[model samples]
Target: MKFISVTTADGLKIIINLTKKIWPVAYGKILTMAQLDYMIDKFYNETALLELIDKGHVFYLAQDDNNNYVGFVSYELNSEPNKTKIHKIYVLPETQGTGLGRQFFELVKEKAIENHQKAIFLNVNKYNNAIHFYTKLGFTKVKDEVIDIGNGYVMDDYVMEVDILQ
Candidate 1:
């Protein structure tokens, strides 16, 4: 698969739609539909995505040889010293066990290195097995926090970092 940058407004909507589909499938069992819907509306709205895109955040579409979008991710400069933050990463549930996520991270890591970032960091849901995947990619847990997502809902996440300069 190849990664393409999101360049059109419609492209961002497609990404968000895919994200909405994947979110419930991925987290519905772990979270209530009410919670999931709330978070989706609160975070994935067009305005929010447009803001990120405008700020030059990197958003990638993982496309097949035929150019079908199979997955996507978003990231941006981290406020921490010499680090880049992976804001979101998702692969379609139907496409998940195919090593696409690994390839996706490899591409992101290469980009980080090219930008001279010493490390990369990401936040994963506390209940998700993605920690195993991230660990396999050399990410080590650095901290854990509950981030408020408006209302009374919050996301419990494990913050992990991989040192590319090591």
Candidate 2:
């Protein structure tokens, strides 16, 4: 797989829609439809995504030899010192168990370290099975909390952090 930085608004749209596809596949069994819909509309909207890109966040779309986009990951350095947060990571259903997610995550780790980030953090829905995936990739659960995402909805997440510099 070849991973490339997204350079156009059209590319961003492809990433957002891919995000939608993976969200349902990864989160639907854990979250209610209403909750999932709220997240998709709030975060995957073009304007919202553009704002993220404008804020110095990095977005990557992974493609195969045929140029078929199969996965994506996005991350940003926040105000917190020495830390980078991975906002989203997803691989298509057909590629989930094929090591693509691991490759994408390693790319995220490289990007974080290149920026001098010592650690990386992300929140995973408690009911999702991806915790094992993260754990296998060296993330340790630091805390569990309910994040209220407004509109009477809340996400019960396990906040996991990985020490990339280690």
Candidate 3:
């Protein structure tokens, strides 16, 4: 697998497509249809993605040997010193058990280390199955948060963190 830095408009568009493909499957059981629709529009819209990139978020697209886009992750330096916050990570449903998620996470860790980050953190919906996956990858739940993301939608998530130096 290869990780491509998403810096161009075309690359951002590809991430958008990947989001559309992955989000429904990943969140369908855990979130209501209305919530899914709202969150997708709020977070995955092209304009929003461009704004995030402009705000210094780095995105990487994961491609397989056949050049198929299997997953993607985005992260940025957080307000906390020496820490990075993963804003997003998603893999194709079919690729979920094939170790692609781990590969993607390793890439994220490499990027964080390159940026001199001492720790990496992410938020996972409390009811999402990915929580177990993150735990298996050595992330520990630090705190629970219920973020009011507008439109009557709230994200009930666990703030998971992992010390990269370990």
Give the runs in model 2 whose Cα sits over 4 Å from its true position: none
Each prediction's number of clashing residue pairs: 0, 0, 0
lDDT of 3 by residue, 82-101 (tens): 88888998999888899988
Provide the lowest-lDDT 10-residue window in model 2.
Answer: 73-82
lDDT tens per residue, model 1, 24-78: 8899778888999998987788888888878867888988888778889888865
Q: Can you give the lDDT of residue 98 in candidate 2? A: 93
- lDDT (10s digit) by residue, model 2, range 1-166: 8998985789888988798788887887888899999989998888888898888788899998888999998888762688988888889998888998899888878877888888989989898888999999999999998989999999899999988765
Off by over 4 Å in 3: none
Error of 1 at 139 (Å): 0.7
- Report the error of model 2 at residue 155, Å: 1.2
| Backbone-clash count (model 3) | 0
TM-score of every model versus the real structure? 0.94, 0.93, 0.95
